[model samples]
Target chain A: MSMRDRLRTMGLGAFGLLLVIVSWEVIGRNQLLGRTFPALSDVLATIVDPARRGLFQRALEATIGSALRGFVFGSIIGFAMAALGVIFPPLRAGLDRLAAVMHAVPLIALGPFLIVTLSREGTPTAIATLAVVFNVFVATSAGLRVGNPLHHDVLTVLGAGSWERFRRLELPGALPFIADGLKLAAPAAVIGAILGEWFGAPRGIGIVIVSSLQNYQIDLLWSAALLGAMLSLVAFGAFSVLERWVVGRFR
Target chain B: MLSPGAELSSESDKSADGSTDPSIEHDDISISTSPVLPHVDASEIGPANLSLSGVTKRFPLGRNDTVLALDDISLDIAPGEFVALLGPSGCGKSTVLRLLCGLEEPTGGDVRIRGCHPSELVADHRLGVAFQDHALLPWATVADNVALPFKVAGQPVDNDRVRSLLELVGIAEFAKARPKQLSGGMRQRVSIARALALRPEVLLLDEPFGALDAVTRRRMNLELQDIWSTDQITTVLVTHSVEEAVFLADRVVVMTGRPGRIQTIRTPGFERPRSPELLRSPEFHELVDELTIALDEEPA
Candidate 1:
């Protein structure tokens, strides 16, 4: 993009964000939604408040650790499933239905079952993995199918075996789609971790959210929610950059 | 045993110089031509005789509906022979090439390369093919693309062979460039280079230069001729261009559409390493004209 076009894009984004912040602050100050809603400034103050700094730090560390672990494990499992389907044509329809069913089952309903099976400490990562697997699986399966037909013909004429075809053509061709899937999966991992924490995890942003809601600590609740949003946004933004690089290299 | 267009043989006087050494005129070529333009030696490449006996192809159009693409086609390609399949659009000339490559199977009869099934040649890694699409991997550098056949065959990539093939196609400087980075002609050159990497016995070309403009296509034809001169692999090219068929092939198999079958097979008895000058000769135009008329004739 040209310098002016990039600047224009940033300017437009800033304007939209400013509009959102101003409307939020206005509604909170006027008590438009009653005492439950807090102004943006009050939420920021609570987030930076010295007394709550240690608590926020521990929660952030735990949630981030779980999300990262889930993202890695989910990506591996998802890629493996997609590769398996490609290798075994007979399994493709079954795998597709399985992925659809997995995605259809809500994470909230699975939270209690996960807690019982894996205990409170493992629930967060498990939920995050479930949340990420479907996106990665769908994207990877489609990606594997998106290879150029001509390239396949070339390999066939070259006498490439199934393994060689997968390694040289299908794998390289699927990188862009896989990167895009990962981009979406990143934020999903964060949301899953936060949701998992709600089912009585020891310490996380979700715990802060639940505790603040019950105790009527409106500012703390808003602060925790905002922090969760920021984590998700950062994950999305990082993968966006990586996705662009992969697309440029592979596509 | 008269030729089909024998009445148009007035250009016989012009063919006297058809046997002249083509390398003497290489300096006049616009592109950086190959230096080692050897005459095609029949004994150089092994027995790669391609034969299709009573081959028929039918593609399913819809439920209970089928389109006849080719019918009752039979031809035998001798070793070290260059044959061109010429026809109008949708005449199934490409289907014939595809059958020989084992890309598509005939609904009837048999297709063989060197006395074995077409698939057998593919399995043995003795088949080379270049399509109109070029089919170059967009992500790979030209050098890697050329080395792909070796890797596919579970053999170590011969880098020296790859480099020389690029030079043979006159694009050695673009070795590190990706397919998207080059123009249409350049990409086709890379595709041709990759096809020749393994030095396969049978070479199949389906309008490898069909996508290029006229000027570039002519230049590519000359380059292909230079390349063909060295290896003399049993080649079968499918094309719509009458001139290209005559210039490149020892035998031009003309076909008609709608249940495509051979209309005529004309042998342009021009000597090896034919130069650009041959393209302008009266004999070349005569053969092209005859084939074009044959191509235009409606199938009965």
Candidate 2:
């Protein structure tokens, strides 16, 4: 496309963003939920207050660090398990059945048991990691299974060995699907980490929200919620950038 | 008549005296009298260049009966000869290519290349194949797609060789472009370059240009002839178009339907390094007509 067309597309996207912000500001100012719904300005005030008082520097670090650690651990285990499943049919079949059973079990219900079994030492990191693992595991396994049959035949006719075929054809073919799964799992991972914190944790956005609720500190609760949303958006944006880089290389 | 064990040099001299070089002419005299001897000497040299003896392929039909895809098929493709297998859709034309390439095994007979089974020599990079579909990986660039055969065979990339082949196929400028970015004929050219990457002794092409339009197909046909003449690799092309079979092959083996068997082989009496103008001549039409009649007479 021409440069003028590209500029018009970008301009339209910015206009859409402005429309969303205007709607949110108008609704919040009119007290749509009868004072329970915080105004956009009130939430912005709370976010800036912590930074003004200089308390946000430490809290931001603690929340982000725990979430990042959980995401890394969960993704590593998920990918290893997916590779194992592809290599071993029996293991893949077993995992498929297990996933079906686990998916039905609510993630929220597992919180109390995970705290007792894994977080007995009061480490919130372990529980958060556990929550993210299930989501990543399912996504990765599904992605690996989506390799195309025509591409497989191309490898076969080229006389590629089984392992070589997996590396060259199957792995690259599965990448787009795997990247899509990871993008989706990013936000889920953050939600999982924060949820794990809600049951029991020394520090996290979830703990702050709960404490603020107990004291009826509405502004603080809104601030914690906004920070959690920001963390989710950041993780999502990071994966989006990585996905573009990978897809770009292939193209 | 030349026996299976006879040397080709003596037989070739005998055949050349009575008729023009079989490579340039298609005639019934050529078909009936041309030596049926194996291409390469198996005893002194390696295996027969490419041999399929009593090869039969059958698929299970659930009941007691089996569907014979290929039956008692035997042929030898000599190095640097361009042979075309001309048959209708269900004659297992493509199946023969797969069997020779070792993508599928023959149920009843042997597939030998240079004295070894195809499976045994695959690692040596002796076999190359092109399918009906271009089969270029959409994500890979033209150069990368063409380099795949070498990569899979664990050979180092010969960038100069790849560039030359791209130039031969007239697509050197599109090396950095992805397959999706190129036109259909361009993609198939990339596939052809990839098949030649290993300098394979035997090249198998299954209707490689059948999907293209008439104009594109004719252009590709001319390009293929030029490449084949220069490269001198043994080529076996499976095609349904009679014109394609007549234009490209030293011998067009017309196969019967169903339990696919070689019914007749026709030799077109045309001079090679064939030009595009040769395709419009009366001789080409006569050759195409003869194959068409043979095909129509075959049992469905």
Candidate 3:
């Protein structure tokens, strides 16, 4: 896309964000949703207050660590699952059903079980890993199947074996799709990490949310929620850039 | 089925002798003039280098429904000969090429190269094909795309061979460019170069220039002829263009659509090293007109 077009798209997005912020501030100040909803400025003040800086820092660090670890682990497992399906055609139907079944089970319901079996500290990363696996598996499997059939024919006539075909054609062709899966998996990882922490994990944004809700610390709760959202957004933005580069090269 | 080694080596020996003499003389011709193609008579050739006897293909379209794409088609291509399967759309000409390359199996009958199954050639890494779509890897540079056959064959890529092929196809300068960065003609050239990389015993082309403009297509045809002349590999070209079939092939096998069958076979009988002058000749126009008429009547 041209620079002007990119700028115009960014301008429109910024306008939309400004409108949302204005509406949020007006509603919160008016207490339209009652005392639970804090004004935007009050939430910002709570987040920036020097007294609570250490609390916010520790929470962000723990949550970010869990999400990052889960994202990497989940991505590797997901890709492996997809590759296995391609390598063994007979196992494809079974693997597909497995992924579907995994996705059907909700992360929220698994939180208590994970906390017990994996321990409080490990639960967040485990839940985050589960959250990412389904999306990556589905995206990668679909991606691996999407190359031009002509390319397949060319390889076949050239006497390529299954391994060579996968290595040379299917894998490279699936890069854009894999990147897309990773981009989508990023936000889910963060959400899963925060949710896992809510089930009595160590210091994290999720713990701050639950404690603030219990004690009626509305400003702190809002601040924590905003921070979690920013974490998800940052991961999403980074992967979006990577996705564009892959699509440019492989598609 | 023909045994692999003994027959192939003999066929190669015969072709090698025919091609060597013409190539030296061919180097004297300017780029604008066509290379002197070795004239090997279809009748004088020993045995079928590529044969399809009573070939039939039926594609299952849906449950209980099957489409008969080709019915009882048989053809024999001689060693070091160029044969063009010329027909209108859905004539199963491409199917013939597909059968020859082991990409598709015959529902009945046999498709063989040197008496062995086409798949045998494919397994031995001795069959090469170029499609209408080019199918060059979007991510790879032109040189790498051309080098792909060697890589696929589990052989070390001969960089010099790849470079010479780029030069042969007149795209040497575009070696660093990716498929998407080049024009349609250049991309097809790269595809052809890739197909030729391993020096396959048989070369199959399925409308390699089908997507280009008339001017570019004609130019590509001339270049293809020049390339083919040097090696004289047994080749089968699938195309609908009457002019193209007449200009390039030793024999033009015309076919009819709807249960595709060979309607007729015509030998243009043009001399080797046929030039641009041949394209405008009365004889060339007459043959093209006759084939065009035959193609027009294919539906009936």
Alpha-carbon runs more than 4 Å astray in model 1: B1-47
Mark the regions of model 3 whose C-alpha exceeds 4 Å error after superposition: B1-48, B297-300
**Clashing residue pairs for model 3:** B2-B115, B2-B116, B37-B273
DockQ of 3: 0.83
Would you list the rank order by lDDT, best first?
Answer: 3, 1, 2
Residue-level lDDT of model 1, residues A148-251, one tens digit each, is 89899999999987788999999899999999999999999999999999999999999999999999888999999999999999999999999999999988
Q: Model 3: per-residue lDDT, tens digit, A1-251? A: 99999999999999999998988899899999898887898889999999999999999999999999999999999999998999898989999999999999989999999888889999999989998998899899999999899999999998888899999999999999999999999999999999999999988999999999999888999999999999999999999999999999887
lDDT tens digits by residue: candidate 3, B56-100: 999999999999999888776666578899988888999888888
| Model number with the top DockQ | 3
**Using Cα atoms with residue i matched to residue i, what is each candidate's TM-score against the true structure?**
0.92, 0.85, 0.90
Candidate 2 C-alpha lDDT tens digits along B262-300: 777666657876888888898788878888998898565
Q: Give the Cα error of residue B42 in candidate 2, in Å.
A: 8.1
Q: Candidate 3 chain A vs. true chain A: TM-score?
A: 0.97
Candidate 1 vs candidate 2: the TM-score winner is 1
Flag the better candidate by TM-score, 1 or 3. 1
Candidate 2 Cα lDDT to native: 0.75
CA lDDT, candidate 2, residue A120: 28
Model 3 per-residue lDDT at B232: 62
Summarize candidate 2's per-residue lDDT along A108-194 as a digit string, tens digits: 787788777877223445555655666677777776677666567777777887788777876776676567667776777777777
TM-score of 3: 0.90
